[model samples]
Target chain A: MQDFLTIDALSKYYANGFEALKSINLRVKESEILALLGPNGAGKTTLISTICGISKFTSGKITLAGHDIIKNYRAARKMIGMVPQELSLESFETVMNTLRFSRGLFGKAPNDSYLEELLEQLSLLDKRNSQILELSGGMKRRLSIAKALSHEPQLLFLDEPTAGVDVELRKDMWLLVRHLRNEGVTVILTTHYIEEAEEIADRVGIIDKGQLLLVEEKESLMQRLGQKQLTIELQNRLEELPTKLSDYDIVLAADRQSLNYTYNMRSGRTGINQILSSLTQSGIIIKDLQTKQSSLEDIFMSLVNETAK
Target chain B: MNYYGIKAIYKFEIARFFRTLFQSFVSPVIATSLYFVVFGAAIGSRIQEVDGVSYGSFIVPGLIMLTVITQSISNGSFGIFFPKFIGTIYELLSAPVNFFEIVLGYVGAAATKSLFIGLVILGTSTLFVEFNVIYPGLMILFLILTCVSFALLGFILGIWAKNFEQLQLVPLLIVTPMVFLGGSFYSISMLSPFWQTVSLFNPVVYLISGFRWCFFGISDVSITTSLLAVFSFMTLCLAIIAWIFKSGWQLRT
Candidate 1:
């Protein structure tokens, strides 16, 4: 896949000398879903704003479809669409008119059929004639998506697209994002929801304090950092871990009825067989056993914590 | 040139104006009619003529100028200000449209709106007083220039203003007073020499003077000077707007 968007050494600074975005570099491939995960004030919105040309960058270069964002902004901007974090919409305008206005703003000819199809996909077809103020919060979020996609932009930026919504709507938004990617619209979304990134993102970029910590394939990221835990339930309660199990990374449960062993899946030897033999020699009778894999949330927390230190 | 982008913004703004028909259109017309009742009937009864024209008829040009100038500013300022206030301006800023297209859309719509209101007030004034436009073409030219120039100023105000209070401050405190004391009601000639000389500095004076010349062929200042003043004001406004877009001062920041 070709890089549809390339950002090199981009930095943004306020007049008061606050660094909103540090020297950042990234490339987004066509038809790929890239999720940017960050905490509050992590410069997620600022990055998206700069790419969409809403905020001016102090230095560095960004190009969309091989056009420099600043020098060739018209061509670059025409190919890009952004759904802002805030539900900013014309309250008095009807849903359909809002979409039409957005499409026209991007210099596209009128295509009501395309717009109607978008509305239908977002379940907003019934509310096309309804004014924005009349819609519910979820409906407004959906309308923002429809507006962004109205121009058929090759690149779409969804900034916290499901920030405040119900579980059902969040799922719907995820589905829509996946559907957009399938339609060959490269999607870059900023979110703090680990589940959202884990569920839909093909690649995940972790950012902290205006710096991108890492960007890698989601599965690779999980596999490289992920840890697995094995639980051994004992029939007889133990006051502490036996000296025989000290060689392994194992801990006795606080309740004294079970033992937990942590190991890396990527390692050639997990030592499960040796640990079981050792436990048997120590006269520990295992009544039940279970294992659990570390979730992406755990990996994310550890990475952020490492950076915080 | 992004003509479609300009048309989109222009149409959106015009639609908003039509949506609030009473506030945008009817209210100004009603206010102008009341001015005729109060100033024309009440004041005109005492002063029968001023500069060889009926007191009722002489104020016609000034009345239209007042509405056109203020309405242009209000319409222009609010058109951009409301979007900023609601944060919807992000769409405008992020769109493929350039600053020129954006300004044309907003300022053009504002001018068109003020022009409509000015023409309506002119028509409504006829019910109370009779007036003839000696140079109908020049009258419209002045009207349009005022609308466009003042609308450009309003666009600047919209971008510069931080809040609603700030948005209304200039129009209320500065512009409205300028129009009133700018000889909108009485000729500057009525003032003593000292005050009359001071009134020459008021830009609105030139606008009213030039517009009045279109109607009765009488003006407080020469037609050439009036035209020069209008052009200079417009040039200054365009320069400021250009700077705003170039620096990304308020809108982009």
Candidate 2:
């Protein structure tokens, strides 16, 4: 993948002396959907604001398509589009006027055809003539996205794009984002919904407490931190683990009906065969066996806790 | 600098103003008519004349300037302040439009509204009393300058204000006093000599004098001094706004 945007040594300090961002460095490649997952107060919004040139960085450099964000703000801003968390539009303005005005702000010639296409894509064509104040919350959110896309920016940043949305709407928005990616746009998403990221993100970056915990491919991250639980139901109840099978370090249920074995998937030697052979040699009959795999949420929580330390 | 960006924001702001035409246009007309009836007729009857001009005629320029000043400040401040207050400033800030372009679009629309209200008041004045326009060129210049200056003042106020109450402070506490003390209903010369001298410190006095000079060719302050004060205030306010836009002070974070 080719690097399309680069953020180096970024930091933000408010006038009130709050250090919201501490020296962040990240590289976003072209045509990749990168999800920035974080809990509250993790600097996700601050980082996006600084990169987009809306919030000034205390000290750092950001390059968008090789253009320095600070030195060449107009060019950098032109190449990037942002959908902020707030669904703020001129309440008195019609949907059509809002998009047209936003398009004109970029100095692009008025093209009704292009605007119509954008509105249609956003599912706002039906409400184009309606005032923003008349729209529902979901429609307003869609209008926000439409306005941002009017200029057709290459790098799109979505800050909690699906917050407070229902399951159906959320799924529709994810599909729309995926469509944008297919059209050769690079997307950077920030969300508190872990499942949203796990379902759609190609790469996941976890940030916590103003620091980047880790950035890795979603599959490899799971493989690296994932664990497994193997449960065996004995044919007969037992008072305790056999003295020989105690070496396996299995936990016997309080009722003595089952044994649970926890092991790291990354470890090559789980010794499952050894445990089975030993159990059989001791005449302990096994009735059923099952295994459970760790989910992405497990990895996310551990990563957050690991960074806290 | 980008043509499309300016057009986009300009068109949006203008559309918003017109969308609220009932309040934006109708209220100003009603307010201006009331001022004419009360201040121009009631007050003008007690005061016969000022600076060799009819009292009713003399207050016309002052009334128009007052309307323009208040509208300019209100439109400019509210246009930006409400978006910020409701968290919609984020949409504008994150858009491809630069800060300068955003200001131009918003303040430009405000200035246009102020000019429209000023002209409407001027037209309404003719219905009540006869006034002459001695210097059309100077009148246009002063009208344009007043709108721009107050619009910038509103921009600063919008950025500095955190709540609706703070937004009303400058218009209520600051602008009202300036307009009333600037000689809207009476000539500064009518006050004692000491008060007339003290009035020079109020910038609105110069604006009123300059605008009045356009209609009657008579002014309490020197023409050159009035022009100089206006240009200086415009420059200073523009500089502060430009700095705020560059720093993204309150608008961004």
Candidate 3:
């Protein structure tokens, strides 16, 4: 089965001898939102640039809809669009002219109606005649997305599309990404915010230190990595763990008021029964019990720490 | 082919040039006319004629060369350099168009802008002196070739420039001195024999002589050598540009 976008062992080594991207392999299914989560200098932008053929890769292959990004670049590029990490725009051009010009660069016929529709969709209708420099940071970013989508590309790369915007604009971008995905526009977005992936990505790929650490479905990755904590409210403040409860991974709360047992939910038999029975056998009275599943942020931090080692 | 891509980039650059009309077009014309007034009044009386042409008319061809060369180079460099500086080049590189088309769009627009300036300076010069073009066709030919070749050189300089100061380096340091020393203000024959030989080695001499020949039917070197020299230099600049794009030098990082 041919993926919509396939990166096979794509590697890029800068002339300064800094390896920006290690041997990376990734396959993005058609119409899926694949959130690329990584920390800074994690080769996320490098991978996107190399795939777009802006930065030449030292080795490996990138194919967009069955065409090589290098050899069949024109055909391959026509199927892709990129919203760069930087807010790079032709500052003097009006939103309309820039969109028309960008679409024309892909050899696409001039379609003012389509551009007008795009403007309306992006809420840029009022700013169509405005020069890019006059637009605010949020508007400029929307124009970047509009320009990237002007050619009606099949695959889109949004490199930190919502990196620095306010919460409102970030929500707007997430909605926009969801809209694109609904229209079957395959999206690959890189972000450091784990909650972003949690909100919209169908799948998530974690990358760090120039290498891809893992790629898994959003639901599965959550279930596989998420930890469940069982908090037992003590009838009385406890000083330490008893010998009977020593076998479990448990910690006393800061107030010395409760026992917090941390265990991976993926591993069956969360040791709830064992801890509960041991507590009863030890003659400790429990006021109440509560369970909490860790969020994606904690999982991401642990994953990054795991790879750093 | 990417004609649309070429046209888009060309329009983008041409629009940029027009936005700064005073700086891009008018300043050079005003400066060139002042040269005619000062040099024609101050130096004209001292030396009556250069090769039977009035001293005022004598420098017209060289003046055009100097202004056109510098205008094209600076415009070409700045047009591309600003995009790179502001990070718009990535948008260009990521587009579907090839490098050659990108270069053609930029170099073509730069050449066109400089050609218009060259003709404007020519029209302005006619206001000051009465001169006839010996071969109007060849005159336009040399003017256009000079604009294009210098524009190409500017493209190379733009990519190689790390900063704005470096962007002006070639036009100010190298091209200006070469044009001045290449018989712009005086005839090479007025020099001592040794200096005359040294002037013969300056590449701008061939360009000026060929251009001047189109005006007065007088030249310092045979017309063929002049043509060969300009074309060869243009070809060399083209080769360097091709190499730069192929290696992704300064463009890809």
TM-score, candidate 3, is 0.90
Q: Mark the regions of model 2 whose C-alpha exceeds 4 Å error after superposition.
A: A15-17, A225-260, A263-309
Reported per model, the fraction of native interface contacts reproduced equals 0.83, 0.74, 0.65
Clashing pairs in 3: none
How well is each residue in A179-200 modelled by candidate 1, as lDDT tens digits? 9999899999999877788889
- lDDT of every predicted structure (CA atoms): 0.91, 0.84, 0.89
Candidate 1 lDDT tens digits, B1-253: 9988999999999999989998999998999999899889987878868899998899899999999999999988998999999999999889988878998999999999999999999999999998889999999999999999999999999999999999999999999999999998899999999999999999999999999999999999999999999999999998898888888888886
Per-residue C-alpha lDDT of model 3 across residues A73-190, encoded as one tens digit per residue = 9888888899998998878888999998888887788899999999999999999999899999899999999999999998999999888899999999999999998998999999
- Tens digits of per-residue lDDT, candidate 2, B9-103, equal 66777777777888988898888899888877887778777877888898898888888999999999988888788776766775666657777
Order candidates by DockQ, high to low: 1, 3, 2
What lDDT tens digits, residue by residue, belong to model 2 across residues A146-166? Answer: 888888889889999999998
Candidate 3 structure quality by residue, lDDT tens digits, B1-253: 8888888889878888888889999999999999998887676767788889999899999999989999989988887898899997877888888878988899999999999999999999999888999899999999999999999999999999999999977788998999999988777788899999999989999999999999999988988999999999999999999898889899987
**Native-to-model Cα distance after best TM-score fit, residue A86 in candidate 1, in Å:** 1.1
lDDT of 2 at B98: 61
Give all TM-scores, in the order shown: 0.91, 0.89, 0.90
